[model samples]
Target: MRISKEEIMDAAKKLEPRLIAFRRDLHENPELSLEETETAAKVAAFLRSIGLSPKLEVGGHGVIADVVGSTPGPTIALRADMDALPIMEETGLPFASNRPGIMHACGHDAHTAIVLGAASILVERKERLAGTVRLLFQGAEEINAGAKAMIRDGALDGVDEIYGLHNLPTLAVGMAATRKGPLMGSVDRIELTLEGRGAHGAIPDQGADPIVAAAAVISGLQTIVSREVSPFSPVVVTIGSIHAGQANNVIPHRAEMTGTVRAFDPAVRRQLPDRLRRIAVRIAEAHRCEAELRYIEQVPVLVSEDGCLAHAQRTIDWLLGAERHAEAAPTLAGEDFSVYLESVPGCFFWLGSGPSDRAEDAYGLHHPKFDIQEEALAVGSAALASIALLRGQSNHSLLL
Candidate 1:
C-alpha cells in the first residue's frame, strides 16, 4: 500500500521544526566538499538521535546510516548532499550563510532536512516497513565525486535501489517531477590555450596572433552542435572565459580559454574531447600557432533506471495522487547521482520550491537571491518516506 498523505503530513509536521533548525545550523557554518567536518559530525549525531548508528567518513567525508526493517526485505538508499557552493551569500536572511565566501544556493540544505525528517518517521514507524533503509550523506556532489567516493566506501553495499532529489526554483513549491530517461547531461570542463609569437600591435605582420586564432576557434566551435551533431540531438558549447593580452596595444603570445561541454549520451560525450581538441588544434595551426586542449570529465550522463523510476513514480502517485504528480522535461545540467545509479538502480528527481516572481525568467536556482519556500521541506520529507515504505513491499531487492 502507498503511504497516506495524512501520514506524510503528520511526519512532516513532527520533523519540520527540527529540520529547520538543522538546516539553519548547516547554513550558518557552510563547508565545501571533503571539508564538511562539522556537517559530518552533525549528521552522525542526528542519525544516532534517530536510533540508527551511522558510519562516518566512509568516503573521505561520507556518512552512512542503515535501519533494518521488522521483516526480511531489500535495502533502499536515500541520499542528501552535505556540501555548500563557493558562492557568497546575499539572501540577507537571518539564517543566511555565516561563511562569507560560501553558500548553499543549490538548496542542499533543504535536501538534508527533508531526508532527516524521513529518518525520524522511519524510526517511529519501522514496523510498517518490510526491509531496510539506508541514508547517505554524501560530500563533493558539487565537485562531482561524492557519489563515487561514497560507493567506494561501501555506501551502496547490498543496496537494491536508491533515490535522490533536487530543488527546482521554477516549478513552484510542493510539486515534484522527473522522467525515466536521461534526466541530466554529462558535464565536462574544457580549457584551451593558444600560443603564437607576440609583437607590437602597430606591426600586425611581425607576429602570429594567438588571440585572433582563439577567437576564430571559439566561433567555429558552435558549428559542432549546429552542423556536426544529429539534428534531433542537442549540445551546448559555451566558452565562458577568455584571458590573454595585457593591453590592446600589444599582441599576446598566449591566449587561454575555458568552457564547459554538455551532452546527453555517453557516446557523444566521449567523442567531445576528440572533436574539441581537433577543432582547437587545427584552428590554431591554421593561424601559424598551436593550441593546447584539455578535457576534464566531471560528471557522467545521469541515466535513470526504468525500474527505479517506475517505482518512484508509483510512490509519488500513492502519496500525492494523480493531480499532484506530473511529467517534466530533462535538463542539460549534470549531477553526481550518476555514480549512485551505477551501483544501484535509482532515479534523481526535482522538487519545486516556488518562484520569486511570476516572470518567465525570474530569479532561479544557483542565484544569490534564490530562496525556496520552507514549506516545500515538508513535502519533500513525505515523498522520501513514501519511497522507503513502498520499497518495503516490492521485489525483495527493492530495498537493496
Candidate 2:
C-alpha cells in the first residue's frame, strides 16, 4: 500500500527533532569533497541505527544502504551529497562549523538529513512497502567527482529510478519546484596561457605584450555568447581570474587566465571549446603571441526524464498541495547529481528553504552566510518519503 500524505506528514513531524539534530551535527563537522570519511561514517552509523546495513567506502567515502520492502517492485534510489565547501562559516548559528575554512554553505547537510529522515519513515512502513529504496550518501559533489565515483562503484547496479533534491534559499519555505528537460547546465573549466617575449616596459617594440593579448582574448570570448551563440540559447563565458606581469617596469613572458563556461543546450556546449580556442588563438596571434587553451568538460546538463518528472511533481503536489509547487526555470549552476541521472531515469528538484520574515535567511547557496530554514527539513523529508512510497507500489498511479 502506498503511504498517505497525512501519514508522511506525521512521521516527518515526529522525526523533525532528530532530523534537526543530525543536520546540526553534520553542519558542525563539515568535510571537503572526496574526503568525507567522518561524514560517511556518521551516515553509515545512522543507517545501521535504523536497522539498515550500509556499504561503506563505495567510492572513496560514499555510503549506500538498501531498505528492501515486503514485496517485489521497482527499485528506487534516493541520493544526497555529503561534501562541504572551502568557505569559512559566518552564520553565527550555535551549530556553526567547528572545522575552520569549511562550511555547509550549499545545504548538503540538510539534504543528507532529509534523506535520512525519509529512510527512517520508509523503514517504519517497510512491511507495507512494495519494493526497495536505496540511500546514496555521496561525497565530493562540490568538485563534481562524487556521483561519477559512486556510479563506477555500482551504486545504480539494480536501481530502476533515482531522485534527489537541492535546497533553494531563494524559494519561499514550504514549497518545491522542478521541471522536465534541462534543469541545470553543463560546466566546463577553461584555462588559457599566452606566451610572449619579456622586455623592459619602456621598449614597446622589443616584447610581445601577452597582457594586451590576454585582454583581447577575454573580450573576444564574450562575443561568443552574444554573437556566435543563439541569443535564445543560454550560455556564459566568464573569466574569473587573470595573471600577467609581476613588475610594473617589465613585460611578462606569459599571461595565464582561468574561467568557466556554462550552457544548457548540448550543441552549444559541444562547440564552446573549439570556439573559445579559436578566439584565444586568433586574438593572441593579432598581438604577436602564442596561445594555449585547455578546456576540460566537466558535468553534463542535468535533464529530467519526462515520466520521472511528472511523477515527482505529482508527488510534491500531493504532499504539499498543488499550490505549493512551481515549475522551476532552468539554472546555469551545475550539479554533479547529473552524473546519476545519466545512468537512471530520475528527477532532481529544489526544496524551498527561504525564510518569509528574515531577508538574511535567504542568503544564496555558497555564500558564507547561507542557511536553510529548519522547517524545510520536514517538508523535504515528507515529500521524499511520499515519492518513494508511491513509486514503490506497482499498482499506484500518480493522480496527475
Candidate 3:
C-alpha cells in the first residue's frame, strides 16, 4: 500500500521543528570530508531513537540503516551527504559554522537533515510500505570519495534502487527538478609540470623559461575544447591553479599547473585526458620545456535512469502539484551521487531552496555565503518519502 501524499506532507510538516533543529545543529558544527565522526554519531543516534539500528562507520564515518516493511520487496536506498566544505561560514544565520574553516556551503547539511526527516516519515508508515528504505548518511562528498567508500563497504548490497537530492539555491522553495539522463557532468583533474632551464630574467637566451611554456600550455589547453571536440558536446578545461618562480627577475626552473575537466559524454570524457596530455606535453616541448601530466578521473557523469526518474517525477507532481516539477537543465558540476547511480538504478534530483526562485540572485554552491531556504526542508523530506513509498508501484497509485 502506498502512503498518501497528504500523510507524507503532514508528517513532514509535523516534523519541521525537529528537522530544522537537526539541520541547524549540523550547520553550526560542520565537519570536512572524511572527518564526519560526530555527524555520523548524531545520525546514528537519531536512527536508534526511532527504533532502527544503524550500522556505524560503514565507509570511514558513513552511517547506514534500513526501515523494513511488513512484506518483503525491493530495497530502496535514500542517500544524504554529511561532510561540509572548507569554506568559512559568512551567512550569519545565527547557526553559522563553529568550525574555523569548515562550513556546510554545499547544502549537505540540508541533504542529511532531509533524509533524516524522510526516515522519520518512513518509520511511521513502516507497516504500510511495500519495500524497505535504506538510509545512507555519507561522508566526504566534497572530495567525491564517500559514495565509492560506502559502496565498497556494501551499502548497495541488497538495494535494488537508490534516490537522493541536492538543494539548489537557484531553484525556488517548494519546487523540484530533474531530467531523464545526464543530469550532471563527470569531474577529472589534470596536473602538468613543465621543466625548463632557469636563468636571469634580463637574459632570455640564458634560460628555457618554464613560465613561458606554462603560459603557452595553458592557452593550448583551451583549443581542445573549442578546436578538438564538437561544439555540441560540452567540455570544460579549467586551469585553476599555477605555481612558478619565487622572485620576479629570476626564471623558474619548473612550473606546475593544476586544472579540472568536466564533460557529459562518456566518449568525450575518455578522450579528454589524452588530448590534454598531448597538448600540454607538445606545447611545452615547442617552448623548449619538458612536460609531465597527471590526469585523475574523479567522478563519472550522472545519468538518471528513465524508470527511477519517472517515479521521482510522479512523486514530485503528486506531493507538490504538477506546477512544482521542472525539467532541470544539465550542469557541469560533479556529484558523487553519480557513483551510486553507476552501481544501481537511481535518480539524483534538485530540491528548490532558492529564497526568491531566481538562482542567479543567490550565492552558488561552494560560496562562502551559500545557504538554502529553510522551508525546503519539509518539502524535500516529503518528496524523498513519497518516492520510496510509491516505489515499484503504478502511476495510478499516486493521489493526484
Candidate 4:
C-alpha cells in the first residue's frame, strides 16, 4: 500500500501551518553547534506528538526517532541538520532571531521543519508502511562535527539507506536538484604559521619580515588550483583570515593564516593539503622565514549512490513534475551530510527556496539577509515522504 503523490501532498498541505510555525520558532531561537539543547527538546516533543519516541542526546544534543512499520522490513533514514550559523539576523522578518549574534541563515530551520512535517505524514501512513523510517535531527552541521558524533553514538545502527536535503536559495522556489555523483565537495581546514625575527620599524635588514613571507605565500597558494590541479577538476583554496604585526613600526616575528580547501575528486582532495603546505613552505623559505602548516581533512565528498538517487529522482519527478527537478552541477561547497553518506549508501539533494519572481528576495546561504521561501516547506516535506515510501517498498540493496 504505497502512498500516492496526492496523499502525500494532502498531508503536507494539512501540516503546512504547523510546519511554518515550527520553522519560525526555530528561526527565532537559533542555537549554535553542539549547544542545541532547547532545539533538541522541541524536536523530541514534536516527534512524541507524532506518536514516535525520539532518543534525545544521541551525540551531544542530536535526536533520533524510529517509526517501525507494522511488519518487519529494511530501515530507511531521513536526516535534517539542527544548527545555526554565527551571523546576526538581518532579514527583519517578524520571527527573526531573538538571540543576538546567531541566526538560521543557512535554512537549517526549514530543513528541521520539513523533516518534522515528513515524520507526521509518515506516521499517518505507518500502518501501510513496509519498513522502518529513522528520523535523524542532527546538530553541529555548520562545524562538520555533528554527523560524526551521531554516527559514533549508533545513529546508523541497522540503517539500510539514508536521505537528506539542503535548501538552496539561488534556485527558484518549487524546484529541486541533485546529481548522480559528487554532488558536494570534500572540506579540509588549512593553517599556516610563518616564523621570523622582530625588530624596529626603521631596522635595516635587522629583522626577518614574516608579513612579506605571508603575503607571498598567499599569492603562491592561488597557483595550486590553476597550475597543479587538473583543469577539469574543481578545487578551491581560500585564505579566510590572517593575522600579523600589531605595531606600526615593529616587524612581527610570526604571521598566522587560516583558510579552507575544497575538491570533488578524492585524489585531488588528498593531494591538496600537501600541495598547499609545500607551496607555503617554499614561498616562506624564499623570504628567509620558516613555515609551519596544519591541514585537517574535515569531511569527504558527497557522492550519491546511483540506485538510491534513481529512487529519489523518481519520487521527485512524480511529486513535483519531471521538469521541476534538474541535474545539479557539483558544487565546491561542503556539507557534513557527506559524513553520513560515507557510512550508508544514500543521496543528498537540494530543495529550492528562492523567491519565485522577486530576485531581490533571494539571498545566498550564510548571509545575514538569508531567508527561505515558506512555500518550500511543503515541497520538501512531500519529496521526503515520497522518497521514504518509494524506498520502503523494496528490499533492494544499493549498488555501492
Candidate 5:
C-alpha cells in the first residue's frame, strides 16, 4: 500500500499551525553548532510523543529515528540541520531567540520543524509504507561538521538513498526548486602567512615589509580566477580577513590573511590549493619575503543524482501544482549535505520561504534579519513526506 498525495498534503495543511508553533519554539531557543543540548531534548521529546524512539546524542547532539513499515523494502533517509548562527536576533518577533548573540539566521529552525512535521505524517502512514524512513536531525551544519559527525555515528549505516531541503528566504513561499547536477559549490579555506625583515618606518631600505608582500600576494591570487580558470567555470576566492602592523612607525615582520574558495566542478576544486599556494609564494618571494599557505578542503560540491532529483520534482509537482516546480539556478554557496551525497546517491534541494514572488526583494539567509514565511513550513513538510512515500512505494531497484 502506498500513501496518496492527497493524504500528505491534507495532513500538512491541517498541521500547519502546530508546525509554526514548533518552529517558533526552536527559533526562540536557538543553539550554536555542536551545542544543541536543549534543542536535541526537544526533538527527542517530540519524537517520543509521536510514538517513535529517537536515539539521542548521535553525532554530538544529532537525533535519529526510524519509521519501519510492515513490508520490507529499501530505506530512505531525510536530513535536517539543527544549529544556529552567531548573529544576534533583530527580527523582533515575539518568538525571537532568547540567547544573546545567537540566532536562527539560516532558517534552520524552520527546517527542523518541517522535518518533524514530515515525521509525524510519515508515522501516521507507516503501515502503508513499502520501506523504512530514517529521520536525521543533524547538528553543526554552520561549521560544516554535522554531516560527518552523523555519518560517524552510523546515521547512514542502513540507508539506501537520502533527500534533504534548505529553505531559501529569497525564493517565494510555496515554490520549490532543484537542479540535475552540481547544484551547489564546494567549500575550502585558505590561510596565508608572510614573513619578512622588520625595521623603522623611516628607514630607506632597512625593512622587508611583509605588508607589501601580502598586498602583492592578494592581488596575484585574483589572477588565478581571471587568468587561469575558464570564464564558464564559476569560482570565488574572497580574502575576508587580514592582519599586519600595529604602529605607523614600525614595520611588521609577519602578516596573516584568511580567505575562502568555492567551486562547482570537482576538477576545478582539486586545482585550487596548488594554484592559490603558487600565487602567494611566488608573489611573496618576488617581494623578498617567504610565504606559507594552508588550504583546507571542507565540503564537496552538492551534485544531485538524476534519479533522486526526478523523484523530488515529481513529489513537488504532485503535492503542489506542476507549475510550482522550478529548475533552480546553481549557486556557489556550499552545503555539508554534499558529504552524504558522496557516500550515497541523494538530492538536496531548495524550498521557497520568501515573503513574496520576487526572491531578490527578500532578505537572504544568514542576515541578522533573515526569516522565512511560515507558510513554507507546511509546503516543505508535504514535499519531504511525498518524496519518501513516492520512492518507498516504487521498485527501489528501478528508481535508484
Candidate 6:
C-alpha cells in the first residue's frame, strides 16, 4: 500500500506557484477571526476547482471536503486554520495586504494553501487509498471559536484520527518539529475589577482610591507563580491591559484590569483563576476597596499523542533528513486545536517556514511583518501528503 512519494512530490512541485499565489492572495485579503467570508469563498472555489464539494459555513467559515477511497478503512482528517490576525502587514511585498488592520501574519495562509495543495493530490490518488480523508479548513483560530464550532457542526463525523501543522519562523526551512505531549499550553482569561471612592489628588484622606489597590493587586499576582506554583512546571500570569483614571487630578472610582493565565496541566490551569481571585480580593480589602475577579476558560493545552508524533516526525525526517530538523521547544502560547486532541489521538507539528538567509532575524508569526519563504509551500505539501499516506508498522491497531 505504499504511495508514490515521487508522484506526490511532482504534483506538489507543479502546484507550488498556484499555492504561492493562493497564500499571497489570502495574505493580501486577510480577514479577522470568525469573519472569514472572503477567505472561505476562495477556499470553496479552489476546492470546487479541484473537484471537491466543499461544505461552506460549517462552524462559521470552517469548511470540510471529503475524499472517499475505493476500499473501506479508516477516516483520517487533516486540518488547517484559515483565520487571519488583526495585525497590519508591513512586509512591503507587492502582494501586501490591501485590507488595513488585518493580515495573515500567523502563516495561516500557508497552512490553507498547503492543505489545498494536498487536497488536489489526495483527490488524484483517492482511488489508491484505503480509507476516507477529510480536509478541515477552520476559521476563528485566533479568537478560539472555530474548532468548537466545527465540532458542534460535526466536523469529526467519521474522523478516526486528525493532524494539523503550523509554521515556525524561528526554525529554518526544510525542518519540521513535534513532540509526544503537551506541545502547547492551556489558555484562560481573567479580569479584576477594583471598586473605590473617587478621591482628589491633593486630599490625603478624602476617599478610598481603587487605583492604588489595583496597583497592589497587580504586583501581588506576581508572587503566585514564584511562591505558589511548583518551579518544575511552567506557569504564566500576565496582565496585558489596564484601564483606570482619565484625569490627572482625580482618582477614578473604578479600575478594570484584564490578564491571561497559561499552564500545561489541568491542576495548575484551574488553580490559577482561584488564586488570582483570592489575591485580588485580599489586596483590595487591605485598601478598604472591594475587588471582583472573573475567570473564563479559553483553550485547553495541546497534548500530542505518545508515539503518534513519532510516526509523523519520521515521515518528515525522510524528506528533510536530520540536519535541518530540530526538536520543538515548548511555549506558553495556546492553540484551540487542543480541542481536537481531546477526541482523538493526534499531533500538531510546526513546519519551518523562514528563509535561511535571515533565519536569525526572521519575522515571527502574529507580527505585522511576518512573511514565510515561498519554497516552504512545496515542502509542506509534500510532507503533509506523504505523512498522511505513510502508515507505519506501529499503526497496527489503526490499520485493523
Write one digit per residue (lDDT tens) for candidate 6, span 1-400: 5555567778899999999999989988899997899999999999999888999989988889997777776788889999888787788999999999888889899999999988888788776666788899999999888899999999998788888899888877777888766789998888889999898878937878898998898899999989999987889889998898898998788999999999978778877877888999999999989999999998999988875687787777766677766788898899989999888878799898887877769988788788888888888888877666654223422221
Cα lDDT tens digits, model 2, 1-400, are 4356888899999999999999999999999998899989999999999999999998889999998988888899999999999999899999999999999999999999999999999899898777899999999989888898999999999999999999999988898989878999998899999999999999979999999899899999999999999998999999999998899999999999999999999988999989999999999999999999999988999998888898898788888999989889889999988988888999999999998565334789999999889999999998888888888654455222
Give per-model TM-scores. Answer: 0.94, 0.97, 0.97, 0.97, 0.96, 0.96
> What count of clashes does model 4 give?
0
TM-score of model number 4: 0.97
Error of 1 at 328 (Å): 1.1
1-400 per-residue lDDT for model 3 (tens digits): 5457777888999999999999999999999998899999999999999999999989899999999987676899999999999898788889999888889999999999999999999898888777799999999988889999999999999999999999999888999998987989999988889999999999979899899999888899999888999998999999999999999899989999899999999999999888999988898889889999999999999998898888888778888989988889999999999999888999989999998547659898999999888899999999998888888455546353
What are the runs in model 6 whose C-alpha is more than 4 Å off? 392-400
Backbone clashes for every candidate come to 9, 0, 1, 0, 0, 0
Model 3 TM-score relative to the real fold: 0.97
Q: Please rank every candidate by lDDT, starting with the best.
A: 2, 3, 4, 5, 6, 1
The CA lDDT of each predicted structure is 0.84, 0.91, 0.91, 0.90, 0.90, 0.85
Choose 2 or 4, whichever is better by lDDT: 2
Query: In angstroms, how far off is 37's CA in candidate 3?
Result: 0.9
Residue-level lDDT of model 4, residues 43-122, one tens digit each, is 99999998998999998999999988786777999999999999989988999999999999999999999999989988
Whole-structure CA lDDT of model 1: 0.84
lDDT of 3 at 225: 86
Model 6 poorest 10 in a row by lDDT:
391-400
Q: Clashes in model 4: which pairs? A: none
Which one wins by TM-score: 1 or 6?
6
